[model samples]
Target: LAEKSNSVVDNDSKRKIKDKGCIPGLPIDGLPVYTGKEVAEHQDPDKSVWIIFKAGVYDVTDFIQIHPGGRELLLGAGNSVEPFWKVYSQHHNQQVYRILESYRIGNLREEDRLKEDRTQDEMESLEFIPERDPLLLVHHEKPFNAETPANLLIQNYHTPNNIFFVRNHLSVPKVEEEDYSLEIEGIGLDRTYEFTLEEIKTLFPKHTVTSVIQCGGNRRNDLNKVEMVKGISWQLGAIGNTRWTGARLVDVLRYCNADLEHPEIKHVQFEGLDLDAKSEPYGASVSSVKAFDPLAEFLLAYEMNDEELPADHGYPIRLIAPGIVGARNVKWLAKIILADHESQSHWQQNDYKSFPSNKKQASPEEFAQAHAIQEMPIQSAICLPEDDQIVQIKWKRIDDQTKPFLDVAGYAWSGGGRSVIRVDVSIDGGKTWFDTELEQETPTKRSTTTFSWTLWKSEIPLDFNQLRNTGNQIEVICRAIDSSYNMQPARNEEIWNFRGLLNNSWHRINIKVV
Candidate 1:
């Protein structure tokens, strides 16, 4: 035996010391530290992979049974980065970096070393299957999965309570409407008042606004394929257009009985029920100008799609700031604070800011140097028959509403209150174009236009007898021009980011002409 050393292993001390020439033990740092890539490989066979993310030092032991995949996959790796980062990237924080540095010996791979070049054929031969992820709302009980389609979303005025997507950063508290009360803090007497849902209905003048709440990460999947990016793999469905009915937040601000001339007030803060790893609640803010603007269309919405709000969707009350990213739509009526400073929550001070293509995981000091992403860009998508298909087509006249026919429709909206002006549809391979019969007007401010999706129907021009004899291919393409004249980028590479977000490419569908 050569020697003995001391190292911390899973909170227990292990003793081992190694010498140079055939000695006993090596230092704790000499142990092979597993990376995210390694954890993924180990769990691929049986998903019960428990990887202790070396960075966050998180106690994921309890989450094993609750994991959607299975406990087996969450138990595979110990003290590793793969499973944790892969599943919890959105929850990553500064503390995680500190934990990683404490254990890292050095860079596992040397940058100067070069390996044999991979041929194009070799790279092309590799098979990759993307993981489907659940949607993470700032605060909710469960993250809603994204396999739903538009017709289903529009089946009713309001999405089903259970079917409604859940985006939460913390556990859903059992809040009772009768026992609930809203507290308004800032420049006036701090007061807590309670009201019944029915009392709120009769007390305040009811207003209705059709609005679309879209996630900032709506098209991020497209961004990710171009390059490694941060954030969620949100599909296009991160957006939903719904009718919101409530009292204007501006009205509430006035009712709070604050002095209008208060000079110290600079920002309006909104807090959600979401909590951090340390049980800190997530919060964010907007400028007092934006929050109090008469025309901002911000609402303390109590009803969605004309029904009682669902539990998954903030339940009794939630803030609805149309045209703003989903994060600002704080769920679970908590507290609204007017402050001389911005929100102190982790999300407001740390995340949701965009960076240049070259930056990655910059420090808070560095991020503050960049601008926050307040408004989303122009984007559109086709919800009819996706990219490839075999389908039964029933042709009918546009004037005949009674007949069922193949209808091509989709949703389009732009950030900063821009409206979709025109949508062009091409069914004959884009060789020629036809202006879709679009709705003549835009929806309410910050509201998603449902009928404007340009659900076009064309009678298969009875003149294709000759072409029908031979196998034919039908290619459909759709694009939108927004009020600001901004259009979707022609390719994904143009807007690629390290963190996959904002993937708005022209949606096309190809079908066999059966």
Candidate 2:
């Protein structure tokens, strides 16, 4: 044999090693030690697929089809798997190790092994600030998902970029303005178009839309109270209203000669710059009808609240699909694909879906049957006097006797371009309700759509002596009515779902009167 060679295998030497006789798991006199360059040559799945795991080479060509995470997520088919496996720690188990052992082919040369070790060390040293707002409650760190507290969310009509709720699916990508480019492609387009930051800014007239972007799972904690549901246990602050300024998506589509009238085009997929370990970008799709609709009020926003978009909010650009669920208003937008089908991304296909209340577990069949959440339902929440809080009420003379009166303030919103016309507040758990004064920021004349949220406040009168005699605690509930006359459901149990999406139930809070 080759005298137990420890040196790296060149292209010609690797071919020679492959020709030499060897058996699986058997002791060979001169087992091949492949160089990193040699390993990269087998990346194409149609030819051969190789991956290095802890200095061990494995031919995972057949295993690709059986990989639980799917074949596309195999991560660098012919490169070291250490960096990716570090991000996806699920593969660190003994079961996955044994499975990899079955596909062992050879070992990485000592020189390449050392290089991979150094690369992994560099990757481990990278740090990301997964959070920005101290008041926002964090749900996950790596993906950097957080929600604003109800009290802080209603402090202003336009939520500040710093404290705005963030719902990222991956680490916030660092994008430089000079290097940024927005791509437009796919089957529905006559030709593809690429625009730099400056080109996009000057190419079209800047349009502004004041709108609300709400998470599909807003108020999910209420649903969780009725029954355990899967999702970030967002209390009530997963929604925000902001003024977004950018070029119209329709105008951009026209500039690119997109075949919007094409009958085959069903969805417009948006891909973000943020990527996962597999290098797959975060993506979601909106209906082409909405994308092309002149009155839909969609925008490719470069500015939020008249300021440049913050890094956490798609610094260079983002899709602002007003009146739609926030998930469809994709951030860090880099590519717009006019496709015949919806985006096959995990967020579009599996998550942000509404399931039947009876569905206890998330299954393939349930996911397949459920439709992705688009527009939200009528929703409102009490921001001040938090649940289980003690409120010192001021005494007021009512019928010549002392009675407690306090101001209750909160926000109310609806989806599908509907405005919140009325918000009813009840201090006795829906037994009696009083209408609150609704205030909405004036919409831009260009935007005929009503997409912004309304801040509602009401001063409630309480009988102090009657409450003191019965109990100190009282339940306060609020429900909203949309312009379409649609009202929030009376209870969470009635509208609970497996994914905890669209929980537009009456918001209730219990406060101790002092």
Candidate 3:
């Protein structure tokens, strides 16, 4: 027709290039180039949707509805998708990158390309994901929040790293281990101290601490059963036991020349590399007392289950504040501060706090007054039968009496190093109770307590008459007592809060007892 391009389009070359996620023939350079100004003009839905990933420009107008992130994909409509990808770490995979490449229309103009990308290689590196266990019960995918399945959770006293529960508030950071460093500073320190990953490994002695890391909202779903609450509907699987191997925090602080005894030093705040929209890293803090206490067993853990820490669980470095709620055990740790007061971060001041039942609205003044959740409450959960699972009644000797029974098993543990002492089961819904055989080891260290979880199993007598009265259905409820005899409440109504945190009420499940 009018004019044919000078460069001939090789059909085989085009097919191979297309398979590698690139255009065919535009000016014979393979793709058209557009400036940032041209791309910015397509923000309106009526025009088209253009987004940039690294130096590549993609037209995702047709892929909008099919995006796994749903409508949130529109967040990157007319700008760089880096911000969205930072919050949604799930997109950092080769498969996702290939899918994104399918919509590539052109390249960003070199003049308009990011200064940081111009000098880099054409290909972008993706993060490694080794903990994509199929057994995990995923609750959210954006930031990758998942829990261990109940049936698999109680099978091992020490949880496997691959199957361990993962809780992330922001995107999991992709930190290069070779360039990793920890910065320690604040008012309590004589001066700031920075340690490279190698220096930390060589400087401090490796200490193994067996502990249980549990989310404060471990049983938030139970509280939701009472009324509606605001948070991830986590079941009992939001906890796991692990043998963390790392350097003691007290030792690290001392090496940094921090004045542990300084009266002004009251809190130890931690910040992670994962950031939010404002580029602020995830932050939290714990009391200086717990940070320095020998019994507290604080650690700068780099290994989980005697292996290198998983990426989702905090690869290079993470805090292991035993007995404290998981929220305070910040992952992908970047900085630590010793100060006179607690961290002023959003998580510490507003989010992880629990409010009373009478408090209806989440007001700023009220959140400021409310204390942050540090040590988690005592908790236990049924693992064997599972909720809504059909269990067959078998004849067994329970409490030395031969009767129809259901084999029950679960896990229990308490915060502040409080060992789980006893577990009680009730088939009649708290009308009566039976003791369970607890499988736990006594603490060996003089100054330390058992920070690990307690595994308990029991056989509960099932009443056929009671099943008939309840329409062939029965409820299994359980509660645990800590070393201090702290027992869980019988009902979730007793501990219901607006945020639905610390739901340590009786762990219950309904099953068909036929």
Candidate 4:
């Protein structure tokens, strides 16, 4: 068999292989080379198959069993780069190869590369058990915390109940809605007011507004290069725009006998249903100016996107404060307290606050001096056609057949009700710029805007032959100019911080031509 294989290979060198004629030794059958996009797509269980990866390293540790189809198929490849990778694409980065070295299966034998029947033991003990695919978002192949992508953000008025990004510190609690009661207390009041969900909803004027909620660390993933941060590697999707309708928090404060306009009060405290490892619940505090400002539009929302809040996004009742970091949108609303000082919950006192741009986990005393992450910074990201795609088109064909290989689109928003005044897109790494048309859907006030984050777009014209001729490389970047005309820094290094928060540099992507 060795002699036969040697002879076939030796013979093939004598003949030139054409695009269509190479069968047994065809690229797909021989070894696969995959782009990041292709790997993400094939990770789908129903459609995923064993493709021979090129002889190299591959990091499969994190992807092991979360595979919806199971792990055996991948484990079956053993350590050889042949059979499976024959269909998988090869990564080009040395860093990626270095990481993959930790998970290599083993070397392969030519004969073992042939297909074999599965044994009963191998078939029966499918330990994967067909449970839910643990990778919440298909692309990342990991649990959904904060790091999910922006474009992956569901495109409804409110994020779809199922896909709303989850940023849980502990497992979600299964509190019965009927048993739930909201407790409100003000430092000046003699007693706390406990109201059932029904009572709160019926008591206040039902108000609804579509607003975007983002985690303060929405772009923390981009900050890891400077120094390690201590929290979730949330991407832009930590934000979701939803129509929240329910009782105004102001009204609730009024019922608690709290003053509407007062100088003594400084902060409003909120507690969630989540508990720490020791069973202590989580809570946070926002300033009185942020919480009670008529324009802030805070709410004890019973409905998200016109429906009861789903369990993942704070079922039954959740505090919905538009234009603030999601950490303040405490899920499973439990308590609201008015005080001269901030809430004493661990989240308020420790976790959610931001350190000095120069500090790490500051001491408690140092933290006392630090400020909490209230509103998010100006930011944007491209959602469609993704980061890298090999698009085939003729420059002439581009006119009507295919939109320019490069179409820029994404969302942009600012903190403190600051509207995004302009958004710019550049296909050549910002060498040249073009202003994109903003899609304004509703009337935007200083606090509320018809455009939450202005979704902007632009197009580039390229002929197919040119794309194929150019080796298919193009860079796309986007930047937002807010009401203050403060543009995101072009590079991340200038704004690097210890907690990896607010790294909103111009987002860029590169794609190949096919």
Candidate 5:
């Protein structure tokens, strides 16, 4: 049989050999070299499904049925799998290689291989807009995270979209208006309800809420000074106030027949359309009580400050969990689940949690026991005269009196619907204090439901004699009192954590009195 197989083969024999498998010795190194166009033709799963990994092509039609991640996730079926594999790193292991080796058909053409390699590199490169405002201080460029300068934050009552602090975990996904849809599911519902962009607008009554969204690590830089901590060194600019217009989350849940009162529903998990390298969606969760409370003012916002939601700020839809940490306000919203447990996303379980101040080096067990930060504590920061800034003071000697004054300004806010009742400022570093005029743009001044931040300013009567004697350095300190009588701690050491989160200590800034 071996001798007979070695004989000169006819067209029928050659066809059989090719159909069964590769022959022992054949031209083109025992595998046919398919053109780039020919490889693209097999993209359809129903037909011949082919994918390229490295420089080799594989026919994965049979393997698609048994793919653990599902066949729909095989996005590179018609093209190179390098991009998908780069994100889903699990494929880079040896076990996956063994599985793929069985389906290997041929090597990709050299030109196509080089083109795909270049395309993969481009996809992995971090992308950011070059026209970003100069006022924004970039913390990271890959994910395009930045914060507004403290001085610019007080320029207006409502923060402009361009200068708003951006805290992104993944690339901003570009979603088409016509193709956008929101999915609702979980144990509290009988079935899933998919809502198109138009249906979301027409089916519910539009409601607007002027609220403040603050990152959990708003004043992390202050904490970092006391002790080195993990996370972006965000100053006081991580918070922003805006008017969000959309349907109430409670109304939407009820419209979808969600059993908000169901005993099994403890949390509402939100998934964003923005995907990570692993193809997993960015996600977070809020307590079911907060999500379902009509007074909580939660929103599925489509508009920001009367304008259509900008692409940087979640485009068509984003969740606004007022009075909660900004991380819970999931943007570019895609799916919502009424779950018994909190979201299993990395941001929910691992990050955004505060540990004990004494636990300098936290272990995995300690982090697991620590509760995630939801509602922030009393917080305030001086925005006008930034830290280490030199201010020019005007001194006048009129008649028989010498008078000097300085204008101080900043913002204060508290979580869980608490209003900042008063803000106290001291130029002598907490020795002497004076009250500042508090200004807020909320619906009711008496209402404790202060979802917006309070902007406070005061003109302090400075003692020229004392200022001249203080070696030209003045330490200014500010602390806030909430409606509940909660005040920021005197020092960061009191509230310091490994993650540098929720740093609401009395914000201090030293200025040179020039």
Candidate 6:
């Protein structure tokens, strides 16, 4: 017992064992909590093909192979299908939800339900689910969070409005364009100001800025491999680049006689129209260092990708704070507050801040001391030659020698408007590396103002003669360097955290060069 127990699940152990982890369901209302062990105990196909999803435990023995996907549906017989839903979004529709509800025998326990599959406790804040593209992998419904596919993510410089990644904290607010209003008040303002959508657009000159908005939790899945982190198992798709057309936030604040740099103002809070069960709207803030910086390029954006903003993306209006984490770019922006301190919302105070990896639980005092996440760290990912893919080789026969190779491509970016200067690609993993050509949508500009992402692609030459010496597989890797010379950490454990925010580790994927 002095040496070690049979096993442990601390961060160190989880790091050595990198596995795809799932967030267990939490009890809603006063429902019972059932562990995975209990769910597994009921997994006899002849009796009940039990399944766990979100927090629901279902018995589908009567349905059997009658499912539309046939045996494919049984693949998740004894486990949670949350992972499967990441790539298979077709089954996330109302019909599927209803069918699963009919078979529900109980709930998947976290602390954890249930006469009802979900109740007001779980969805009182939710309005209605909006229709999303089947290609966009869904992480949560109701609020409707989803991400783009890796391949499609880089196909366009400005992601299409339809397929753009969404990270809504609550249901899309119902606000008609004519009645939409933005209220401004708090410490720095001379007086409270309220303006309609028309006044906001007509009163100020419209400006456009091409920028990238990425969820702070974008690469959380990578962190989960090291140790299970709490949050959506979001992969690399929770990011998008686009042109935002709106009035400059600086101009609007000045008009209200409250410049962000005012002596009394230390932070700028943005609140959303969508609210929680307690009627507390989604809220976040940026310090004056960011809010007051001219290079910050904060905007009261009404248009996305040159079109009117979609409802799922805060239609009437939203805050587009370049170089900052997406959470601070509040959607369905309802109010702007110039305050002496940061926003006092749950998201601002407790959730978004990064914590030490070793601490499994945090005290309230620890959360209060942590600063809000503003700038993102330098990062990159490999989209082409997906993990475990059978890579097809290409070569020039000028010398009659079959020199095979693989083409790799992906995106890179850094926060605080730091442009991605270079992307290093590797064919034999980190043992070798080569720089790739980068393509930027916006005109080349200063590193501190270049808020968009850089798409990089390269043809990594393969060593045909030595291809089969080690094995039939090739490990594709990428690490980006920002203009500030900040490079992504080489290993996930180097920056592992409990919340899994800001995981900008070197993105690596293994593929077969058969």
State the displacement of the C-alpha of residue 338, model 2, in Å, after optimal TM-score superposition.
Answer: 1.0
Task: TM-score for candidate 1, please give it.
Answer: 0.66
Model 4 error, position 507 (Å): 1.0
Q: How far in Å is the alpha carbon of 94 misplaced in model 5?
A: 32
lDDT of 2 by residue, 1-514 (tens): 1221223445554443344323222222344668889888888777678888766777787766656445654566889776565444334433455566556667778888888888766764574453386877887665566888878888899998888888776678888898999999997676778999999899999999898988887888888777766566788888899999999999999888877899988999999998767688889998988888978889999999999998888879999998899988888899999899999887787678876788655555556566888887888999988998998887778688876787789999888888888999997768789989988966557763689999999989887675886587888899999889999889888998866789888888988877
Cα lDDT computed for each candidate against the true fold:
0.55, 0.79, 0.80, 0.60, 0.79, 0.76
Per-residue lDDT of candidate 4, residues 1-514 (tens digit): 1111101222233232222121222232222233323333334333332223332223353444443223434543323333222112112122223333333222222333332213323423432221222434432211125334555553543555455566654445666768999998876566889999899889889988677777766766667656656455566667666678889988887777777566777888888876543456678888988888766788888887788777667767888877777778898888888889987765565556655567543555655566777777788776654666765532435336634545556777776667888888776667777877786446544534432556676666544565565667767678898887778889776676655667789877677755
TM-score of each: 0.66, 0.77, 0.76, 0.68, 0.76, 0.77
Error of 5 at 384 (Å): 1.3
Leading candidate by lDDT: 3
- Window of ten residues with lowest summed lDDT in model 5: 1-10
Q: Which parts of model 6 have CA positions greater than 4 angstroms off?
A: 1-126, 259-261, 397-402, 442-448
Q: For model 1, how does the per-residue alpha-carbon lDDT over 78-135 read when each residue is reduced to its tens digit?
A: 4344323332356343333433333322112221111111332353244222222242
Which window of ten consecutive residues has the lowest lDDT sum in model 2?
20-29
Candidate 1 accuracy as lDDT: 0.55
Per-residue lDDT tens digits of candidate 5, residues 1-514?
A: 1112112334554353344332211222344566567778887777678877666666788776666445544577777775555434334333356556556566578787778768766875644443467788887765666898999898888888889898877778878889999999997677999998888889999999888899897888888787777667888899898999998988888888887789999999999998976678989998998888888899999999999888778878999999999989999999999999999876787678887888754444555566988998888999978888899876667678877777889999898888899999999878899989988865564465868889999877788678789987888899999989998899999989867799999999999877
Q: Number of clashing residue pairs in every model?
A: 29, 0, 0, 29, 0, 4
Runs of candidate 4 exceeding 4 Å displacement: 1-135, 138-151, 154-157, 355-361, 393-405, 444-451, 462-470
Where is model 6 poorest over a 10-residue stretch in terms of lDDT?
A: 1-10
Q: For model 3, how does the per-residue alpha-carbon lDDT over 68-124 read when each residue is reduced to its tens digit?
A: 334456767777787556454435544466567666666677776655254332322
Candidate with the larger lDDT of 3 and 6 = 3
Question: Which candidate would rank higher by lDDT, 1 or 2?
Answer: 2
Model 5's TM-score against the true structure:
0.76
Error of 3 at 119 (Å): 22
Candidate 4's TM-score: 0.68
